[model samples]
Target: MNTIRNLFPEDIEELRHLLQTVYRAIYLYQHDRSARLEASMRAAIQSCMPFLERFKPHIPAYKQRYIELLKQPDRMAPYDLIICFDRAIYELHTRLKSGEIANRLPWSKELRDLLNERQEPAPESTEGDDAADTERVDFLTSGVGASRGEAAGVARVILDSVALAKVQPGDILVTPMTDPSFLEVADRIAGLITDRGGLVCHAAILAREFRLPCIVGCRNATQVIPDGEPIMMDTTAGIVTRIAK
Candidate 1:
C-alpha cells in the first residue's frame, strides 16, 4: 500500500464516532452479568467482528494516500488529520477481510504515526525505558512466606498468562497473580513471587506441593525484578532482592 500524509475533517470525525461505538460494545460484552444479557453482549461483540477481520490490510494503502495529500498545498484541514486517519482505518475494514491483510500489512512505527494524530517518529529506548539498565535496585518487600527455602536465579516476569512459553527451568517466576493456568510453569520455576495473594492463593498452595520457595503478596516483586536478570529469592524471609547481573 501507499503512504498517507494528511486526512480530511469529516473522515476523522466519522472514525472517532465508529471507535466510540466499538469501545461501548466491548464494555457491554465484558460487563454483561446475567445469561440473557450475556447472549445480547455476545451478539454485540460478534456484530463488530467483521471490523476486526477487515480494514487492517487497507491501512497501508490509506496511509499512503493520506501522506500524498499532505504534500499538496490544498490538502484537508490540518486539525482533521487524526480523524481522517481513523476514518481510513474503518473504511479499509469495510473493504477488505483479515486474510487479505494478514501478510500484507506489517506494522511499523510510521504506520502507527499515520493512524494517530502524531506524525513524529518513535523515541529511542534509554536507560529509563529499560528496567534491565537499573538492575542495581535491590529492595525487599515482605509477604506471606508460604514455602520455606532460599533460591537465587534469573527472574522471569510473566505478566500475562499466555507467556508461559518464557518460563524456563530454575527461573524465578514473577507475576501479579497465579491461577491454575500458571501450574504449567510451576515445574520449571525455582520459586514464585507475586504482586498479590496470600497463603491460600494458588501459587502458595502449589509451592508447597512442588516444594518451591514461594513468596506471595510481594507488592513490587514483578516491577523491581527485571526479566532475565539475576535475583535472590529468600522465601525464608519473604524477600526478593535484585542481584547484580
Candidate 2:
C-alpha cells in the first residue's frame, strides 16, 4: 500500500502532462477552424478580469497565480484548462477501471475487495440520553479564538465530505480540520470547531469570512464532543462547552 501510495505523485505528473497536451491540441484545432473564434476565446477570458479582481481579496494566492498564468503568451483560457484537466482525469479513470493502470499495483486481494465494495451511507444519529438536561454542561474544551462572538447550536461532527450532508443550517460544524471544500456549506453553519489548525489555517480564514464563532486547535474536540449534542462556543474566550441535551 505504501508503494502504491508513493506512485500517486508520478500519476499526477502524468495527468499534468496529459492536460497540457489536450489543451494544446484544442487550442490548435480552434486556431485552424477560425482565427476569429480563437481571438474571441481570448477576449472571453479577458472578460473575467473584473470578477477575478473582486475575488482576489478573498483568495489572493489562487487568484494571483491564475493571473500570472494568464499573462503567459501560450496560456489558454482558465475554463479551457479546467475542461482539459477534467478530460485527463476521465481518461485516467477509464484506464484504471479497465485494469490498464491500477492492475500494475501490487495490491492484496483484501485491499482490492475493500476498494470494490459500495460505500454505505452514514448512520442515522440517535438522540442522546441527556437530551432533556439542558442545564448541565457535559464537556468543555478550549482552543485559539480564530473568530469572535458567541454561538450556541447542535454540534454536527463531520469527519469527511460524505458526512457533510448531516450538517443543517445554524449547526456548529465540528471536524478535524477544514479545506476549500467546506465552503459548500459555509453559509449554513453558525459556528466552527476544529481539532487542528492555527490562526492562519483554512478553518480560521473561513470563520473570519462568515463572522462565525470559531475555536481551532482543540486536539480532542472531535473525540470529546458527541454528534447531535447541543454546544455553546465563545470565540472571544476560545472555549467550547457541550451542553447537556
Candidate 3:
C-alpha cells in the first residue's frame, strides 16, 4: 500500500488527518466490541450463578476475585478485569465439560492445576550480565520490527501526549506505548520506538501509515534510552542502536 512518503507535502498533511480519523474509528469500534463482549459475559455469568452458588463452599480464591471484580470494577484495571473474566469462564467451561467437579475431587487443587497450565514461565533474568557491555555504546535495545526502513534522530521519550510538544520534526519518539492521541504528531516524527506493542499495534499501524521506521515491544526503551540522545532504528533488522557522540 502507498504510504505518506510517496505523497506531496500538502498531501502528506491531508493524509495524516485522514489516517487519524481512521484510527479514531478503529478505536471506537474496539470500544463498542468491548462493550458488547462485556454485556454478553455479564449475562453468561448471571446464568451460571446458580451453578456457582452450588460450589460456593469449593469456589477458589481466583473465582471469588472475579466475583469481587464484578462487584467493584472501579478497583481493578480494565485489562486485568477482562483477563480475570476470561480465565474464570475458561475454568468454568472446562470443569463443566469434564465433569471433574461432579466427581467430588479437590476443587481448589483442580482449579490450581488448570491455572498453572496456562501460566507462562518467567523470562530468564539478564541482571548483572555485562557480556554486551562493550557493544552498549552502539547497541541500545531491540524489539519486533513493525515497520520497514531505518531512521536516525534524537530520541524524545514522551510518556504522554502532553509531552508531545517537545517532539521536533525529525525527532524519534520513544514511549511505553502509543494510542490514537499520538497521531496528532505523526507527520513530524522521524521514527517510533515503543516499550510495548506488536506488529499490528497502534504504533505499528501509525508508523506504516506514515512510512516511518518503527521498533516496538522493546520492553524498556523508555528507561534504557535517554531522552535527546541520538538513536538509530533499523526496523528491518529489528534493532534500535544508540549513536555514540
Q: What value of lDDT does candidate 1 attain over all alpha carbons? A: 0.57
**21-86, model 1: which lDDT tens digit per residue?**
533332333234455654543344334334333434445564445434423313443224323333
**In candidate 2, which residue pairs clash?**
none
lDDT of 3 by residue, 1-245 (tens): 23223435664344334323333333333335476554443443344344344444455566565555555544544345444444454445455355655445334443334322322123335567445633666888888777778999999999988989899999999999885567778999999999986664557655765678889889999998999999888886678888878
Instruction: Give the higher-lDDT candidate: 1 or 3.
Output: 3
Q: For all the candidates, what are their Cα RMSDs to the real structure?
A: 16.4, 16.5, 18.7
For each candidate, what TM-score against the reference? 0.44, 0.47, 0.47
Residue pairs in steric clash, candidate 3? none
- Output the lDDT of residue 18, model 3: 37
- Model 1 scores worst on lDDT over the 10 consecutive residues at 115-124
> Order of all candidates by lDDT, from best down to worst?
3, 2, 1
Give the TM-score ranking, best first. 2, 3, 1
Clashes of each: 14, 0, 0
The local distance difference test score of each candidate is 0.57, 0.60, 0.63
Per-residue error for 58 in candidate 3, Å, reads 34
lDDT string for model 2 (81-165, tens) is 4333323233333334556445664433333442222222232344453433323455467777777789999999999977898
